[model samples]
Target: MRLWFLIPALMAAALGARDANAQQVHFDIDATLPVRDTELPYTLDLNLTAAAPTRIGVGALLDLREIQKIVPERMADNAIVDNCGLQVRLDDLSFQAQDETIGLDGGVTITIFECSRTSERDFQRGEQKRAILANMSTQATVDLRNNCAYFKLVDLTLTAPEAQREQLLEDDTLDSVKELMLAAVDLVLNETPLCPELPAELASLDPVYENGGPKEIGDGGLGVFLDGSVDVSPSTILDILTVLQQRKLIPGPP
Candidate 1:
């Protein structure tokens, strides 16, 4: 089956900023990420050569912790609004800046087995909607990079899929999906990082996905965060990158 694997965005994110990134020192870090029983953890055989990798598995764990650090002592009670409402009291994400990596170096190959929830979902007879994501438990090789870490994915293999839906492994389906994923990774790795453009408020109570409505959600995305955050964390930067993608602010790198 030819599944439309969307990378959750306005446009497929691209690799960019090569010239602006030349002078910096690079680090190549590798790791074996943790995985759920049914899911296949990726062995990030990353060859960053000279860029910092955004280990999503690592970022998710770290970011979650960071966000939790600032949960206000007495958070304000959420107010109910009309229609769809999501009340998220976000604390400023806290991370020890010292933990950041500067680059990727050395011939490294790391395996990651991330955790996943295995369950059978009953698809409605006439419905064709399916969701494929989970909170991943990732592990990595500690401190291979000297200081700053540049990231790369040399070879990554995902080992989990729906057992009953066994058609995913037919022919080049897995390779095709992996290629697309790594392309996005290389885009970020081989260049300067895509910085988030958070608002001055840092956090807010806002109406999400108000404009897109419901029907268009599947075409690209339509949930509240779909405006941007649907793909990236907090969905804020996702909005910024969407504009950039539309304007071609970040062009593709060779």
Candidate 2:
């Protein structure tokens, strides 16, 4: 009897120790987006670190030279050439994590300022226009712990304010701005040529159309409300969530 009681106690203590160690760790994530309607394809990669309850950092790399190549030829009328890479930084994160979920106790933020290039045609004659190529990244402070993986980005606001959109178009580029807005949303959602179906509300955003296609309303911006979220996890988390949840991590839903 005495030995049996001692065994259980010892096991409990060992598990608690393991959970603490797993809480803080570093991770890496990468994915490629599909070619959206009239939009260039690109790849995204990032490094991140999590230190307990609310500290997270996301380092990023992006390549968008394709967008620049197409604009000059296709929309020559409202043409301002833009081509460059992007860097998405997300930090100051505060969140709570549970089994297969990480909820934002604090909002996540990602911003890309006026960080793109313009074509020579943009500088010709009385050309007084500048294109602000940016895709603001949203923060993910949602419940994201399931098994040993982190939560994947499932969604981001798919629209930009009208004022912001106008600011992005320099010269004739603005003429095609409405169409490009859909492409911009496609870039963020990693929507490939085979872009997946979005949630219904997102699909029905347009008052005059509903091809389940991306659209713009009132100048806010064009966006792709993704069908789901992103999943991210470091190795250390598995040891902790396993011990804390008192169960094995289930694999993806059948």
Top-TM-score structure, candidate number: 1
CA error at residue 58 for candidate 2, angstroms? 1.6
lDDT of 2: 0.29
Backbone clashes, each candidate:
44, 35
Poorest stretch of ten by lDDT in candidate 2: 142-151
lDDT of each: 0.25, 0.29
Model 1: how far is 54 from its true place, Å?
38
Per-residue C-alpha lDDT of model 2 across residues 1-254, encoded as one tens digit per residue = 00111223223333333333232221122223333345444322222223223223232222223432343344323222233322222223233323323232212122222433357544223332332333323333212122111123444432334776554344333334334433453454342232322223222211111122221222322122112122223333343334323422223223
Query: Candidate 1 local accuracy as lDDT?
Result: 0.25
lDDT of 1 by residue, 1-254 (tens): 01121222222221222332331211111222221222211111111111112111111011212122222221222211111111112122121212222111111111122333344643222222232221111111121122122334445444434661255466444454456545654663445221222233322212122111111122221111112112223353444344344445454334
Per-residue lDDT, model 1, residue 55, is: 13
Off by over 4 Å in 2: 1-36, 77-236, 239-254
Candidate of highest lDDT: 2
- Model 1: weakest 10-residue lDDT segment is 54-63
